[model samples]
Target: MPEAKETVLEIDLGALAHNYRYLRAKIDDGVKFLSVVKAFAYGNDSVIIARKLEELGTDYFAVAYVEEGIHLRKNGITKPILVLHPQFTHFEDIIEHCLEPNLYSEKILRSFVETAEAKNQKNYPVHIKLNTGLNRLGFDHPEIGTVKEIISSTSSLKIASVFSHLAASEDWKERDFTVGQIDLFRKMTWELIADLDYEPILHICNTSGVINYPKSAFSMVRSGIGLYGYGNDKNIDPELRPISTLKTIISQIRSLDKGDTVGYNRAFKVEKPTRIATLPLGHADGINRIYGKGKAGVFINGQYAPIAGNVCMDIIMVDVTNISCEEGDEVIVFGGPQHPVKFAEAGGTISYELITGIQRRVSRLVIPE
Candidate 1:
């Protein structure tokens, strides 16, 4: 793959395949694997990532919206695509593309039934989401009865799987809470499936959940962040590999005096004479202003720079006085070694925020194995 002319996220499809194989090996061979390709595959080009995972024989693909699933289908992804959060507004389009919806709320369940009936689809796959402890999406224990009623009443709609999100899977300190969620999901499953003879596949493991909570492994596990790396569990045998590399280049360099201020409103005042290199990416490019004035910065020429001043929309200045770097050289923003800017620590945000926040304007170049 050719290097970016300016700034880009190099997506390694090989690494992606590796991560897929790694995660798949961790679970049972019969259990299905659903790779979450939502948010442009975590802001690294959904079509490309989904294509790679699909080629690897992944059981299913997931996205947050109907449009995203349609995009994957448009790009030749025939593998099952699951829409985690389907809005009622796009029900018809979702039907046209044959995308399955994870019906969480009672409103969504009733709406989907009507839409499925209108579309005249038979046995249309749909996932049942449960709100064990997260309290975000999914039906509660009391609502599962309603869900079962809806499932039985609705002819064409079929319950594909029942899933729940883990609040804190990696923190063993929160093991009790995680266990409680698993137990709750399991308890609710029997009641939820009460009259229905066939058990829809049950999946409750998130990336960290899959890694840390083995007993909770029901029928499938939704591996998102772990597949893209950044998982916290060290005990996971296959090891998670980061599949995306965010890179940018210094646009210019300027020498500064001790008393001189930098960036908007003089957010940072130079403590000493310094050589500052300004990058061609900022909040507009997913490198938010939260890194401004006090955070560590991009690594260049085997040395780390210090972020200085308020991050502008299209530019950020870093103190590179101590490093040997010049304009046009690539700057490692987040990912890779020798600096390894953990996305979570980028600005006190999580990896999901960092990856999903990358601007669409930034070019994404895929590197196939």
Candidate 2:
């Protein structure tokens, strides 16, 4: 990999391939693999990641919204793109772009049916989302009859798949809850499937679900974070390689005397003589403000340098008094020896939030396999 001259998110396609293959090996031969590439592929480049996954034989691709799917389509993503949380307003565009929507409610289902009919679409693929335990999106158990009736009443739409989301599949203490969710999903889908003439693909496992619940794999499994090299478990994490490396360079270095404060409101007052290195990224670039004031540190010169003051919009000062580093030295914000999970933990967050929160302003450097 090239040394970072500026703040850049280095995307390792080799790691991506390894992660995909590792996850792929966990499932049965016939089970389909759906890769979730939403939130700009978890704050990495979506198009680049999706293209690589597409080449790697991903059975399907999922995104949070129709626009995300459309973006992939425009960028040569030919695999079936499932829009997980589509709005009624974009029904026309969804159909026009050959993107499928996960209809989770009566209103969305009915609206999509109407739109499909108006567009003269026949048997357009649509996925049914059920609310087993997540309580976020998806139709309830009682709504299954209504869902069936609406779909039964329409020739424009067809059930492509039936799926649900797992709320706490990663936590061992939530094992019973996750299992109950899986059981309920199976029972509900069976009830719905019995009423229909054909069986749509059944899926409920997310990345963690895939690792924890193998029997619940059903017809397919959707993985988001796992493909980005996080299994949500410490034991499994070592088996997967993180695909993104957030790196920045020291913009400037300064020596400060005792009691010398740094950043806005003097949030950091040097207790003694200190050397602070200013990095070119801060809150605006996805380094959360909560990571300021000695919470999180950057890896510099084989050592860790904690943020000395409050994170600014475009800059952050790190105490590098002990590190033998200078201006323009490459710093690992997260990745390599400093994992993103560790960085996120320092700020009381998760890797998902930290990675997905990365701003679009940062330059992306793709490291091909």
Candidate 3:
């Protein structure tokens, strides 16, 4: 590895493949695997991660926007890319890039069809998103009739797939809700298929949905965080490897007396003699201030050093008194076997927030296979 930088996110493609294979094992051999590479592949460099997954034989790729799909297309990604939340304004670009848009509303559906027609395109692939339980996006069950009517009337558009999002696939207590979602998804898609002359692929399983409801894997399953080495369930997490590690080096070390304070607002006061190590990472680097006040810790020389004081925009101080570390010693915020879930849990959040919140400014080092 090159000399330690101020801070870096080390991405291990090998671990990513491991997670993909593990998730693949849960489904039947014929079920297609769709890797969600949106949000920069959950902030792990979508282009790099997508390339690897492409080589690994992913059946499809998904992103949150049309531009994200365009980015992949620009970088030579030819596999079918799904724009999960496409905007009407980008329908032309979506067609230009050969990216499938997830049509969830009447306006978007009509707009995309008109745009495709104006562009002289025919039978452009599109996915329909149903509002099963996550009211955030997708059309309601009643609107399915309107959706079918619009698609049936359009020669410019074709339904490539039908899917929905699960609101709580990870929580066993919400098993009933998930089951309801699965049932509704199946019913809605089946009805839509029966109404149409041709059948499109159907899917609704996200990462957690894939693990907890494998039987609901209809035609294809989308794995987002799970492919990045998190199952959203503790029992299954051990089988996956975290693909990204946020590491930084200590910039300086300070000794504080019993009365001395650290960081802005003196959020942390030295109750006893303490040693603090300042690192070149802070909220600006995706370490939220909520992780301050000893809520989060970083791994240094095999020992966990708790955060001491408020997190600044460009720096943070850690209580490294008991750790055997020096200036420039590498400190791991989260990654590999340590897992970001622990950090998220300690900070009153989830792993998704930690990983996706990582700023694009942070350097990402991709590990060779």
Candidate 4:
């Protein structure tokens, strides 16, 4: 990859392919793989990532909203795209873009059915989300009959898949809870599918679920962070490579004398004479303010330089006292020797939040396979 002159997010499609194959190998041959390309493909270039995944023969793609699915369709993505959280207002647009909506509620289901009927659509694909253990989205067990009644009442809509989200599949401590979720999903989906004219794909595994729960690999599986190169498990992380590298360069170097303070509110007081390097990216660029005050560091010339003080809107000062670095030296914010998980841990966050929080302003360079 080319050296970074300014802050940039380098996306490696080769690594993405590797991760896809790794996850694909974990499931059965017939099981379909749904790549979750939501949140701008988790803050990378969605169009580029989706294009590559589509080329790799991903069975389906998933996004958080209708606009994201529309963006993918506009970018020539031909595969089926699942809109996980569709709103009533965007139901028409979702159908217009050939995107499937996850009908998680009665209101959404009825609204989408009405919209599809209005459009004179027949057998429109839609996903059913069931709330097993994760209480965030999806219909509860009590609503399964109502969901079926609504589906029965509409010819404009068809259930393409019935799926649920795993809340703690990665945590072994929550094994019982995870298994219970899987069992509950299976029971609910089976009950719902018993009377249907056709079989809908049943799935409930996320990346971690794919790794830990092979038995629950129903008909299809969804992977988000794992494809971007995170398995959410230490044992599996090494087997996959992170696809995005957040890189920046040392814009300037400052020599601080004893008793000198740096950044807003004088967060960092120089106990001894030190050299600090100012980077061209900061909180606005996705390096959250919680990573400030020596909480996190960037890799400079193979050595780690801790963030000196508070993270500003467009800049950050790192203590490069011990590192032999100068202005314009490539600094790895994450996705180098240190994984994004490390940086996220420093701020009490996760790789998902850290990566997805990356702003759209950062330039992206794709490394093709």
Q: Estimate each model's TM-score.
A: 0.94, 0.98, 0.96, 0.98
Q: What is the full ranking by TM-score, best candidate first?
A: 2, 4, 3, 1
Instruction: Report the C-alpha lDDT of model 2 over 22-61, residue by residue, as the tens digit.
Output: 9888888999999999999999989999999999999999
Candidate with better lDDT, 2 vs 3 = 2
Better of 2 and 3 by TM-score: 2
Q: Count backbone overlaps in model 4.
A: 0
Off by over 4 Å in 2: none
Task: Give stretches of model 3 more than 4 Å off.
Answer: 1-3
lDDT of each: 0.83, 0.93, 0.90, 0.93
Clashes of 3: 0
- Minimal lDDT window, size 10, model 1: 337-346
Q: Runs in model 4 with CA error above 4 Å?
A: none
Which residue pairs come into collision in candidate 2? none
Instruction: Pick the winner on lDDT between candidates 1 and 2.
Output: 2
lDDT, candidate 3, 1-369, per-residue tens: 554567999899999999999999999889999999999999899999999999999999999998899999999998999998898788778877899999888898888888888888888898989999999989999987888788888788888899999999999999999999999988888878786788788899988988888998989999999998888888998999989999999999999999999989989999899999999989998999989999988999889899998999999999998988899898889974367999989899999899999998899998977
